[model samples]
Target chain A: MKLSILKNELNEAIQNVSRAISSRTTIPILTGIKVDVTFQGVTLTASDTDISIQSFIPIEDDRQTIVQVERPGSVVLPAKFFVEIIKKLPSQHIEIEMQDQFQTLLRAGSAEIQMVGLDPEEYPVLPSIEEEQVFSVNGDLLKTMIKQTVFAISTNETTPILTGVLWNLQDGELKFVATDRHRLASRAAHIEVDTELRFHNIVISGKTMNELSKIIPDQNTMVDIVVADNQVLFKIDHVLFYSRILDGTYPDTSRIIPNQYKTELVLDTKKLTEAIDRAYLLSREEKTNIVRLQTKEDGTIEISSSSTELGRVTEQLEVKQFNGEALRIAFNSKYMLDVLKVIECEHIFLGFTGAMSPIIFKSTENVNSLHLILPYRTTT
Target chain B: MKLSILKNELNEAIQNVSRAISSRTTIPILTGIKVDVTFQGVTLTASDTDISIQSFIPIEDDRQTIVQVERPGSVVLPAKFFVEIIKKLPSQHIEIEMQDQFQTLLRAGSAEIQMVGLDPEEYPVLPSIEEEQVFSVNGDLLKTMIKQTVFAISTNETTPILTGVLWNLQDGELKFVATDRHRLASRAAHIEVDTELRFHNIVISGKTMNELSKIIPDQNTMVDIVVADNQVLFKIDHVLFYSRILDGTYPDTSRIIPNQYKTELVLDTKKLTEAIDRAYLLSREEKTNIVRLQTKEDGTIEISSSSTELGRVTEQLEVKQFNGEALRIAFNSKYMLDVLKVIECEHIFLGFTGAMSPIIFKSTENVNSLHLILPYRTTT
Candidate 1:
């Protein structure tokens, strides 16, 4: 294989795929990035047995030549060293040529690096699925859905099914739900999709979903999602993201969501988040990391926390509206902070059935996102 | 103690002294900062047995009132929590007051924090030294001396004396020397001092010197340094720093520095440093981290390094002049990099005694700083 490419273009493409290169050397071949050169352009692939990433640089971009291919071939070079040398090369253009015995030469300016490359046949092939059962959605909406629910998924391996986010689609609406038994987060959005496109059971591991969220751009551009029997693919622009679906069925979480509440309060989201954050800082030294909230009849909410060894902190916040009766409850401050971070609204409505029941938090402006947290029992 | 101080001023003073607060809880009082309020001003002090820092906020600055003191007393509060609370308090001026007992109230806006305070008498007292043996020098020059030689101090605890920098004064010249037996760095400067202020020996611990270096400003303003039998004190414009001296005899490193050499080379410092840095990055994968340099008869230098596992890198640099015979030598790239960083000159002169002896690095512009590194024996 012999090629000369612009240094900036190759650096960008290599960086995109380098994120998937395995730092662990358990699988020796997994540490190499597969490079393929053709008449059209050059493609770089890297995978760590879980998620695979590939980036392609076409020969022409905006009427400018990027790559000149002398011959078409494939080879796998060490990803870490190759990327470092390319980044530090002191030239605008780089020349890369591979010999018959897998000896690769990289030259730029006055520096030359000769490294042994591995045969491309030793690299693992990425699984390919036919484009079937596909749906189109806005990239920004999909990114928001992933961000809102992915953090709530259980990380414990014992309950493997709970580690995947549940995806349900029906009537041009897409919904995502994730839970760790103690707290839950759910989000829904409307997308343009054919009425016949429906999925009864499809769940992607939360780990893979989170990784996809980072690479996908948060814009209004449309992306196509294709589902196979055991795999799912997201195609946006020139990038393709593939993930394996969980084999077990997700648990039914609809019944656990509270339908009614006796006490309700409406407050500004930013003010309440800051107050809870301050209370959290004071409660970090305590055993349960709990903070108490009490609503008075005069439309005032008091946030307080105390530790036996670290003193106490109390803050007062004004509530917009309160209904039903005065209530006092205690819950983990970290869980509440996490839920507040995902609720994208100026004002939020919180519903409580009783002291021990799970509380629901939803935006007063948008009803698409919902968060629930279980209260901790306090002796006082 | 009862007073109201501007939040910004209080925050800055706390941050400066908090760097010396002990994170270990064995001596609980050492983890807190002592706040002393008097009719004159407020002083914050923190110490960790080895180093002590004190920052004073006067009642006025630039004809503006800052702190208003109502009662004269002192108390110690937890350093971590006090700093955090002051940083996050939502007000321009914070009110801090102590009651009959050891309970302190800190209030700003609608937020109030009540923390338990310890009696200031229980805190460790900082050593007091007279200003009879004091000399004034430019802050910038002192900071430069610490930065150049401190990095060469030995980090191992086997020999306690090598872990400190040796300071010697003679004939109105102050010199600093530090060595770990492998490499050595020395810097000298002329300063104004009383003739009777001569010191035979003064060795400050590396850890304490580093702390002082960070807090001292690099400028042309003068700073007062007071020397005691076992402690040294530095009084800047508004900050006072005290450190305990290391108790050991420093080795004489004057005999180790070579005065003459068999070969000498003069080259641009920036170009040579860059070439050596690139070679070091490529040679890091090898066990010895060794980079080789050969001086050709035509006054050109070739720098190269190779790893059996990663490959090789080579670069050429043009030299201005070369004396005596041609030579080749290998040395630790890290040590060379450190010495190169401290050479403050556009062109540097390198003197080599032999293949196995130490190489001397000196500046052609400034003759006050010198660096020496021992060469590594290589098979090829």
Candidate 2:
């Protein structure tokens, strides 16, 4: 396509769209970025069959011009090389023109680069996400919700559906849940929505969610989510991120979470996280990843891990509050650390029904999210 | 051994010596660090057979108490885990006690870590350099010298000597030279030295030079370099870094560095570097890494590279001065970019003997360091 654009603006847009370009794509044209020039703006799109990303730079804004249209046309340039060239181009203003045989000439300052571009018709089209089931949420809040739950998704391809985070919407609350069987994480946020704009059983791959979170701004901007039959689209400002949903139904996890607790403890989040991390180092050597926690009569908890070759580590911390029968439990130290990391509160509440039951952790100051990790039953 | 030291101080000492611990070493004891505590201070040492690094923290330094020596003993602990644990310790004051049977207890705040330690008797001893061939040089200058010349060392192990940087000390001048046969870099500095301290060919591996460069302080403190038969020791304050010297005669590189030039061009180092770098992107794709530079009838030169499939890039940069004969030369743009990155001067002088001869680059402000890159032969 023929267009004159600011190198900085185009570079940033190219970087955003490049997140969808996979290095191991089987299709030839899929390795390229589809560039289209129109009277309004220039759009750059990249897709890997599973996901698609498009970033548009408008011709003019309030302050200055980002791109100027020369002739409206379309072409697909190699994403791998085009991204590198745009970043290292020597000047502020860049001139891109399409010539005969789809030869694209890129000129900036005193340098001129010519590359053979592929026909735009060969590139895959972005899926049309035209479902009326759409909702708007804060960009930062969406990022946080995805971060808190996406890491818990199972990466095993045998259970394809479990590799995705389940999305459920009811009333005005939107929730995300991910479980790898042993551990589960859930986060919820409130967003304004129409009565008919409710979606359930929608599962998006954890990888796609991670990419979307990266592009979402941390500022208080709004992001619109639209769900189609098999594809979902996340719109953030001038960028569109689209991903295919998993096919199978997600398992019902509500019954696994207990409403009552036999033992409860409230402790500083950072302190407990550090103690678990230190214990994890030893457990990681043992290959069991198991750490023992025992409550004493003196209102202190002892955390210990041992390896046959590396000895043991025992840590004692007087938590803020510990009640119920003196409890002794062994759990995966890595899962506990992961739960503690997503929590931003100073204090966290942990509850256990018994040694073999699922342990739950929730931020002491917030009730919208909770994590459950099943304890490891040791022979001792 | 029993002692209480600040976490920060112990962490720094562990980090400095851990560099010598190799991940792929075959010796079991070599993977651990030897910690020796005496009335004087605590010494941390790590060795990978070829290189040994020891960092000592005195019992008390000036205003701060660095180490409290409760008992004198030594034990070898796993360097990999100790470094990470010291960095993540929970308290400022760390108490380490070695009990019977070499059981090491590390306590910080409310956390206690116990680890099995290997007997220090099995650890390799550091080589003692007895040669009076010792010379002192500025630590900052030594770091720069290593940085400028080490990049050109041959990474190919076939040529054992070329993989090391040749150190030449003569007539109060210290020179570091490295070449991979395709290119050569030489850096020299004047240092006060005894007449008997002249050494012709003492070559140290580029990998060891890189580690030494990282440990050298940025300040202008003196670094005592002691040279022995097959070992070299660099002493900076209380840290001792020792490396085994290569056992081969270095090839003579003087004949390759041309003493005469047919074409001389002076240009802004940064501008030419950027232009050549842009041309490099295309040349890299071609795999030949060939970029052509032709002096115009005017004072400007053209830099261009083309690939059969990916097209070409052409850049023109004006030179401050162009004299001697008109010339068109092709060279590896990546080599030229490497030379440009190491030069500190704004403007650089480039001299070419012929179309296929070596091209020399030197900072216009300094003549003590220079780079030579052999040109590629092109049909055109």
Runs with alpha carbons beyond 4 Å of true place in candidate 2: none
Off by over 4 Å in 1: A217-223, B217-221, B342-345
CA shift of B172, model 1, Å: 3.1
Q: What is candidate 2's CA lDDT for residue B52?
A: 95
Interface RMSD of each: 1.6, 1.1
DockQ of each: 0.58, 0.78
**Alpha carbon lDDT at A379, candidate 1:** 78
For residues B319-365, write the lDDT of model 1, one tens digit per residue: 87788778899999989989888787899999999889898999898
The digit string of per-residue lDDT tens for model 1 on A206-311 reads 9888777777766677878988888888776656677788889888888878888899999989888888877787788675779999986678999888776557
Give the winner by TM-score. Answer: 2
Worst 10-residue lDDT window for candidate 2 chain A reads A122-131
For candidate 2, what is the total of clashing residue pairs? 0
